[model samples]
Target: MTLNIVFMGTPDFAVPSLAELLSNGFNVVRVYTQPPRKSGRGQKLAKSPVHQFAELMGVPVETPESFRKPSVIDDLEALNVDVACVVAYGQILPQRALDAPKEGCLNLHGSLLPRWRGAAPIQRAIMSGDEKTGVQIIQMAKGLDTGDILLSETVPIQPTDTAGTLSERMSRTGAGLWPRALAALSRGGLTPTPQEGEPTYAHKIDKAEARLNWTRPAKTLDCHIRGLAPFPGAWCEMDGERLKIHLAEPSQGDGKPGEVLNDALLIACGDGALRLKTVQPAGKPKMSAEDFLRGTPVGKGTILT
Candidate 1:
């Protein structure tokens, strides 16, 4: 028997999950997404990916600021959903919404829970130099991602992997894993396992954190650049311009921190040197280190502010 499911999600990361359920022939009674907000260069109101997708699929969508209102809870109850599947939905589901689903609410989080349990998990895992992180289908609860695990799939974190690349892989992984987890739940075979130990929260990334600190080790700097790549990218001051570090590698060199050690854009860090591979100067497209060097020259002992 097809299950009555309610989909709750917002960003592009969550679109695949909603599509997966729809394609699998689940009875998706309704969708809950964050309301449209003003954005972009024009600052015009824009609907979220999930919102746009749901509209195209002819599914009724709700965009309540919060699920705390009694009327909102009443609206959810009106749907009489058997289960709710949430993925990257910005808003938190209150206790009432969680209870509204007969079976329960399941969250498709982008990291191994109890590890990176808050916003920005994908970026945090890469920034911390984790070897592996993946999607976790957890039984939702009141606490912040402090939910029991329903299923999980581990994905490797390559040295070259950026947050944007990793997120795309994880998004597809979550879509593939959802059906099996839902089936297990339907069959009463899914066991909820309690999370172990204290959890770490991944606070949202800020523009301030993107400023590169040459006082850090080369490895840490490499991770920082990789973690924030393609969005609010890790940056450093060069020639009075903010240079975004799109790619870099750790190396060995001898010089004061933030000092240019070579013609190849090797910048000295606290412990070693960072070989910048790709960079983007403000108001310019990304270019390779060699290409950038040809345009803007800097030699040994040159200070980088």
Candidate 2:
């Protein structure tokens, strides 16, 4: 029997799984994503990445403000889907919605279960300097990520990995897993196991946390910077203006924290230093440290606040 699927997700992270599912011949009857929100300086509305991709693929899409509404849940039940595959949906599911599909709702979560069991898993993992993290297919339960693990795969977190880079790799790995999970589901071969160990929450990142604190050790600062790069970037004040760091590496040096160590963009930390590799100045596109310094020279021995 062909399983009818209803896809629920809102971001780029979900698209690959949806694509993989469709490519492998899953009957995706509908897609549910967050509604379009205002974006950019123009303040024009922008549909989520999943919404756009679902449309391009000719799949029907629904954007409900909340599933708290009975009508919303009623509409979902109307789909009569055998399964609902959710990823980064950006909304909490009520128990009713979880029970709507014939089998149950399954979530494609970013972290190994019982750890990073909340909104900012990937960023939290990198920021914590974890050498390993992985993806999981879990049976959605009533509480926050307290679900049985259905499938999983471990992946190493390389030293060079930023939140952005790691996310892309994990998404692809998850894309491959979705097909296997669904196939196993069809054959009744999946074995669900209870999650073990104490859990850690990956709380949503606040903009206040993005400010660079040079008083922290160089290695910690490096992880912090990488964890928040490319979006809500780790930033610092220099020359009385804001500078966003996209990539930085720890190096040998010593000075008062935030002091400019040399002409090559090595800035001192409490314990060591870091070379500013990729950066973006206020109102400017991202550029290399060399390019930025060529256009705007920052002298050594100057202190950054």
**Each model's total of backbone clashes:** 0, 0
Per-residue lDDT over 123-233 for candidate 1, one digit per residue giving the tens place of the 0 to 100 score: 999999999998999999998999999899999999999998999899999998888988887888999999998799999998899998899999998999999998989
Q: Which one is best on TM-score?
A: 2
Give each model's whole-structure lDDT: 0.91, 0.93
Off by over 4 Å in 2: none
Candidate 1 shows a clash count of 0
In model 2, how large is the Cα lDDT of residue 16?
A: 97
Model 2 worst lDDT window (10 residues): 178-187
| Cα RMSD for candidates in order | 1.5, 0.7
